[model samples]
Target: MANYFRDYADLCFEAFGDRVKHWITFSDPRAHAQAWHSYNSTWRGKQRGLVGISLNCDWGEPMDISSPKDIEAAERYLQFCLGWFANPIYAGDYPQVMKDRIGKKSAEQGLDMSRLPVFSLQEKSYIKGTSDFLGLGHFTTRYITERNYPSRQGPSYHNDRDLVELVDPNWPDLGSTWPQSVPWGFRRLLHFAQTQYGNPPIYVTENGASQKLHCTQLCDEWRIQYLKGYINEMLKEPLLSHMQMVTEIVVPTVCTLCILISAVLLMLLLQSQS
Candidate 1:
């Protein structure tokens, strides 16, 4: 599978390298690092511009910030989500917590080895520092708590983490199936990325709230508020001064949705001053 993807990427780069300046080998390479690793080692030198990957995560906060278990669970959730991908790009391997827990659980389940694939030292070296910039797509937040799910049910992604996710009822709902407008999560997510990836140049590849389908309303006040709240959090003091940040709002193609453009511009102006 990795070889196939590498071949395809080579073709694209050779065919359109002149026109396409930036090339992303994969959107999220957590589950499949081999392909991106191959690109980094083989095709990266050939490309004229930057090569990177985009990662999507909702920031996880501990249910009990003071409790060690809860804090571990929250960190575990991050290791499972963003760290699952970012660690390889930055640290050149999976998070240590993931390896320890998964390895232990796999042994108890009568498995000889962990389900999570291990990278060779050479491969790890290739993957590390592969990304020129980190692309982040963030929305919503979840309260995480320690929950020891039994591995007897079978080895699965959710059970492996042993955590429970909850959402605050007070958070504003934007009529989506999931994802409430929790602006603080945006700041926390950015901070986590900065700390974990050594403050790599970050681009907010996707950030916005989803509205109900088939709603022909032109005045998307909910979206505007969501954008304002989240962008304002990003522009807060200490954080803004510390990291180089760029936000790109993912807007829908509806012709009547002119309010989104105006709201984004206004927020950008506000962000600049802060």
Candidate 2:
């Protein structure tokens, strides 16, 4: 499977390297280590353009900021989400908490080795320093708490983290079921990526709100607010000046298309640092 992807990437580079300066080998590589390992180490050198992956995650804030367990759980949630992919690109392996927890659970299940994949020393060397940039996709934030599930519940990915997710009631709901206007989370996620991944050039591949499908509202005030709030947070962060933002406005109503375009243009103008 790894070789198959390597071959495909090689074909793409051979065909389009002259025109495409930025090349992303994968989007969210954590779900499949094999693909990341193959692209990062094997196929990366064959291409002339910059190579990286896009990772999407919501910010995890500790439910009780003063509690050590809650803090650790919050960090653990990030490790499980972002670090699971970013760590290997930056640090060459999985986060320590993931290894320890997964190893222990695998042992309890009477397995000889961890269900979490292991990378050999050579593979680690290959994977590390492979990314030229980090692509990020962020939306909303969640309040997290320490919650341990019984082993009897079986060994799924969610339960292994030993944590629970919550949302603050005070956050403004912009029509989406999950996404709330939590700009702080966006800032935190950027800081974590820079600190964790050695300040790699970041591209925000996705971030936005979802409105009702049938609602033909021309004036998307909620989405405009969402963009302004999130982008303003990014502008305030010293570490996030050169990042790119990718967003889509769902304009089901054709008459309101001009309004959506104007809103996006306004957002871009406000986002401009100069």
TM-scores for all predictions: 0.79, 0.79
Q: Write model 2 residue lDDT over 142-249, tens digit each, in one string.
A: 999999655456789997899999998899977658687899899998988887777788888889988744567586877898899999988777634333221223
The regions of model 1 sitting more than 4 angstroms off are 30-47, 148-152, 213-216, 237-274
In angstroms, how far off is 178's CA in candidate 2? 1.9
Report the poorest 10 consecutive residues by lDDT, candidate 2.
242-251
Off by over 4 Å in 2: 30-48, 148-152, 239-274
lDDT of 1 by residue, 76-159 (tens): 999999888889889999999999888888897899899888989998887787777888899889999999654455788888
* Residue 163 C-alpha lDDT in model 2: 93
Instruction: Report the Cα RMSD per candidate.
Output: 14.3, 15.2
Return the TM-score for candidate 1, rounded to 2 decimals: 0.79
